[model samples]
Target: MSFSRIKRACAVALFCLTLSATQINAQQKRTKGCLTECQPRIGIVSAFGGEAEVLLAETINKQEYVINGNLYTTGILRGNHVVIVLTGISIENATMVTQLTIDHFNIHHLLLSGIAGGVNPDYKVGDVLIPRRWAQPLEVYWSANSNVPAPCGTPRDLSCLGLKLSRFTSQPNSDYQIPTPNGPVGTGLFMRDTFVRNNSNFPNGEFKFDYAADPEMYAVAQTIAPKLDRCGPKNPSLCVAVQPRIRRGGRGISGPAFLANPDYRRYVFKTIRAVSVDMETTAFAHVAYANEIPFIAFRSLSDLAGGDDFTDVSALFASGLAESNSSRVTLGFLEAWSQKYPE
Candidate 1:
């Protein structure tokens, strides 16, 4: 062959080889259910449309991935790589999507931001809370009969069940003793379940309930709390009468039911000592705990959870304010976290 022809042939061969290798690597990533470069990134989740919209607005260099009809966006938020997703509006959806995200991405930290019902009397609408721990109030084994006698030496109070109906009862010894600065405080109506799973950090067994948020993330949130804007200027009509504030170090509870009764709200507050109630946080917390990932949540109060006479006002007016406040805090948290742990 002529020298010029030989050189051209060699260049063509090299191009074909590079193209084949690139195609093979792309195929492999798809088959394994991962991105080509699964960079260690923070995972951000929201359960409401408003919450997700707010976060998506701040995302830059966005890339979309559609898996099983669920949309996930990866981008830079607050100068950190993050994968943002919406978990829909229930515990089942939250658990499924959170697990899916962890399975497909190299999630270094998880942060959930959403609106919640105010469970504590001290928290007003639009206030944001970052609870140190989250629990599922609906995971209960109810007693078979209403006639079951209360434990001896204990008061015959149905309020301990944390439900309005007196017929429902929890096991006598199901209370969880949570350690506090003051002392050990007993809360909840069911003992935490121990699950044996290979993928979990605790292979032998570990409690699935009362999942605690990462202390470092909680500390970062506390630092950003004062800097956040608590009052709504965009929607002044929906602004809370009292100036909203960021509250840290409280218990957050989740259940399937939307609590709209005064009795139930009071019961949850008194029994669980919870500041916020939502439908999704506990499931997200559980999955994060099982995967041994550092996780935190910022929940803004949309309503009193049945404390106010205008029950419909929350969904009609206060949701936007709550979402706005939570999104603001979430952005602040992300900025602080990225600065503390720069790439």
Candidate 2:
């Protein structure tokens, strides 16, 4: 019942298919911007507003991009194409923003600049430290022990007793043995998640305990370190009795705790040999390592982490000075790096 009807039906079907394809293409374009080669850019990340503001001030031709409630600024800093963002103040926030930055931008390198508590007595207020490696000291497993005193000759130390720990059940089981006067005893164990990322540069099947900063960047930072100012108008009284100098190539640790206990500070210094401690760098470092991005961190000490007093000095006056010193060195690094690797 008719050639024209059949021809019209075929034409209608063809038109619908074409329209569907067009809509699909449009949706894809909307969801993900046009795929193209991304310009090489460096990422400058800071933990909080104070840390970020210093870097922001150095940016020229700056433009802001708000994605998923995080602010990213793209601009030219010290003659390099760079994007800067703030990763709030904790591990969770730091991790989230780091991955987001890597996913959404063409970041070739990452630099985390911020303030930290001085762990190494050699480092004092307003001293900037560029640690070669970063780790989370708080990532551990705890063993439970009863208050009951150990039998004589059984050893009074809880760690010297063999105890089956309960935490980290999902991780591979291992016993931590601590030696005492009695003998090596099995305490609780700690094992980093080995399956986090599979990278040939890292130990296979083992989550790396420490993430190293790019050595090339570290070298560059060292050259610029001397030019940074140790004292500033923000806090002249808090300046180190001795001239505050930049310290490079040391361990930096991060944790959730706002560390201010003298005993814990001593423990951290003895255990990790960390020169500086902060709350965000290690988390960001971990993410960067997983993504195989080159990273370096510049942390200025705002106060002695319980070496001087328990009161929080970061909020009092030293924060600005720390930020200034760190930013100064960061700018110097960028300028020197640009001279070496002109874009």
Among all candidates shown, the one with the greatest lDDT? 1
Top candidate when judged by TM-score against the true structure: 1
For all candidates in order, the CA lDDT equals: 0.74, 0.72
Per-residue C-alpha lDDT of model 1 across residues 31-136, encoded as one tens digit per residue: 4424423877898989877878888999999999887778999999999999999999888999999988888877889999998888888777667899999987
TM-score of each: 0.74, 0.73
Q: What is the lDDT of residue 47 in candidate 2?
A: 77
**Which pairs of residues collide in candidate 2?**
none
Cα lDDT for residue 248, candidate 1:
86
Instruction: Rate residue 276 of model 2 by lDDT.
Output: 87
Candidate 1 segments whose C-alpha is farther than 4 A from its true place: 1-37, 145-203, 226-234, 311-319
* Residue range 117-136, candidate 2, lDDT tens digits: 88987666667789999977
Q: Model 1, residue 208: displacement in angstroms?
A: 4.2
